[model samples]
Target: MAQQERGNRSRRSILEAAARVFDERGYDAASTNEILASTGLTRGALYHHFPSKEAIASALVAAQSEALVVPDQPVKLQAVIDLTLEFARRLQHDPVLRASVRLAVEQTSFSRPAQTPYEQSNATILDLLRQAREQGEVLPGVDLQEATSTIVGAFTGLQVMSQVYSNRQDLPDRVCALWRFLLPGLATPGMLARLRTAPLPQTAPQAAPQTAP
Candidate 1:
């Protein structure tokens, strides 16, 4: 167990060191040597965890979408909204998340293959939207799959734009604006009126009396 825990720690250190190097120098310029130098670990240690830089990039890309799990809410639509809000906040603070975005942005210019970041994001939203629909929070005519696509695509665009324009400092506000625009089309009138576009403080309670069936 101790050996396994130490291995996990070593892998995480390599990933974090690589993320920082990728964040600062970008993929094309970032070297495995630099990543190792940042970790103060031998190249063998990094190679043991990740065989190549591309593998590390892929891991980071996958990590960005999978890392944040919002607290569940009785109002499923609000949970969806909170997911985006939480993601926006994470982007402002998490270098791993930002580095993932950097690799995605520059992926086409380099050897990194096309990735499934959107597909993963879409699945999460689709699950929430399905739950919302079952609870009558979603509009009767809304296509949940289409809504999922739009929400993920719009959020992806906003992440890039906010990073370019404001270094993602305004991302939370931008995400709130996104929810406001999207909710009108996706949510039932009662849900729309009840949902809060802004994220509640982290310390705030998450549960609400379940909405009427």
Candidate 2:
């Protein structure tokens, strides 16, 4: 049992270190040596857990893709808001998520394409929007497919901008502003009135200071 726990810890450490390196240097430029150096682990230890650099990138993407938790709310629109706000919060604090976003965007540079994470995210948002439409939480006549695509695109753009401008220190405000601008057009009057867009509770570890590549 102790050995298994230690193995899990070692694997997690490698992933986190790889995430930081990837987030800084991007996939093609990021070196496996840097990842191992960051983890303070020998090559053998890293290879035991992950066969190659691509494996580490794949693992980070899969890990970040699974981190979102859909809140249970009577008004599914509110749940959607919660989901976006929470993700923004995580993006500010979580290295793995930051790396995942970078990988998803720059995946064309990689030998193997990374598509599942984006597809999963889109599917999750689309599912929630569909439910909101069915529950009448969305404004009348709103096209859910378009709305879903817009929301995902807008949210991704906002985070990228925030990261560039302020290292995501302003992400909470940007996300709040995003909702304030979007909710009126997206939500029913009562749903909009009831929705809360204040900063969500953050449970992730504090982000380390980012260094330029």
Candidate 3:
């Protein structure tokens, strides 16, 4: 048990170090030596876990969603909104997630165009929209595919601007604005009125279901 725990810690340390390097320098410029320097681990230890730089990056990209701090919401559409909002909040603090996002978006430098993070994001949003539609939160005629694509594209652009101007300090607000604009067209009138643009308090207050049909 102790050996397994130590191995887990070593793997986490290597990943965290690599994440910071990737976030700062991008994949092409980051090196295992830099990652190892930050980790204070021997070359053999790093190779014992991740075989190569690309493998380390691939692991980060594949596990990006695991870093999200999504909170539960009774409304499916609200859950989708919270997902983005949580990601926005995460960008301010989590180096691991930021590196994963950088690798996913800068696919030209990091890997092939088909990436795990985007695929996972699309799947998550699509599933939420499907549930929201069935619950009558989403408008009857809105195509979920288009809606999902638009939300993802919009968030991508929004976060880039936020990162450029404010280092993502303003992302939560930007995300809320994005949702406020999108909700009018995408949600049913009743649902639109009930949706919130802010993060819920940690201790949620009991309320009626946000679903409307």
Candidate 4:
């Protein structure tokens, strides 16, 4: 048990260190040596765990995605709003996310061995949008593929900008404004009305059931 716990801690330390390096140097420029220096881990130790820099990046992406899951109870629009705001806030304040995002944005190509997290996160967000559509929450005429891409693009762009600017105070407001404008048109009437009102649910709401008609 102690060994397992120590292993987990070591892995997390490596990831956090990698995030710092990635944020500071970007993906193309970040080096395993830099990550090792940041974590104070030996080359052999790093290889024992992650095996490659790309693997560290993939772990970082997985950590980020896990952190973003919404609650499974009745969700108020305010909760969603708050959740998004918190996510943006983390992207701005969390060194790991900031670095990973910086790495993602700075990359010019989307080749494999480097595309795992990027592809996975995009797929996850698209799946969420598809669920919203099936739940009578998405507006009609919104093409699932296009809307998903747009939404992901907008959110990703926001994170990248926040990381780059580092001088903005209205990020939450900016993100909220963007979301309100874009989400309303895509929501069903019932969902739109609730979202506009920004009602606070007593508890976390269930994720809209995902089923196809």
The backbone clash count of each candidate, in order, is 0, 0, 0, 9
**Which prediction has more favorable lDDT, 2 or 3?**
2
> What TM-score against the true fold does each predicted structure earn?
0.88, 0.86, 0.88, 0.74
For candidate 4, the lDDT comes to 0.63
What is the full ranking by TM-score, best candidate first? 1, 3, 2, 4
* Model 3 worst lDDT run, 10 consecutive residues: 204-213
**Model 2: per-residue Cα lDDT over 1-213, one tens digit each:** 698877887888888888878777867888999999978888999999999998887887776567667888787888888888878877877777788776766673454563656667788889999998888888988888888888888887888789889998998899889889998999988888889989887654665432211
**Candidate 2 wrong stretches, greater than 4 Å:** 108-114, 201-213
**lDDT head-to-head 3 vs 4, winner:** 3
Task: Output the number of the lDDT-best candidate.
Answer: 2
Full-model lDDT, candidate 3: 0.79
lDDT of each: 0.79, 0.80, 0.79, 0.63
Q: What is the C-alpha RMSD of each candidate to the true structure, in Å?
A: 6.3, 4.2, 6.6, 6.9
The total of clashing pairs for model 4 equals 9
* Pairs that clash in candidate 3: none
Per-residue lDDT tens digits for candidate 1, residues 58-131, read 88777766655755799999898888887777677667777777777677445446555667778888998898
By lDDT rank, best first, the candidates go 2, 3, 1, 4
> What TM-score would you give candidate 1 relative to the actual structure?
0.88
- Tell me how far the alpha carbon of residue 36 in candidate 1 is from the true structure, in angstroms, after superposition: 0.6
Best TM-score among the predictions, by candidate number: 1
Task: Check candidate 1 and list the clashing pairs.
Answer: none
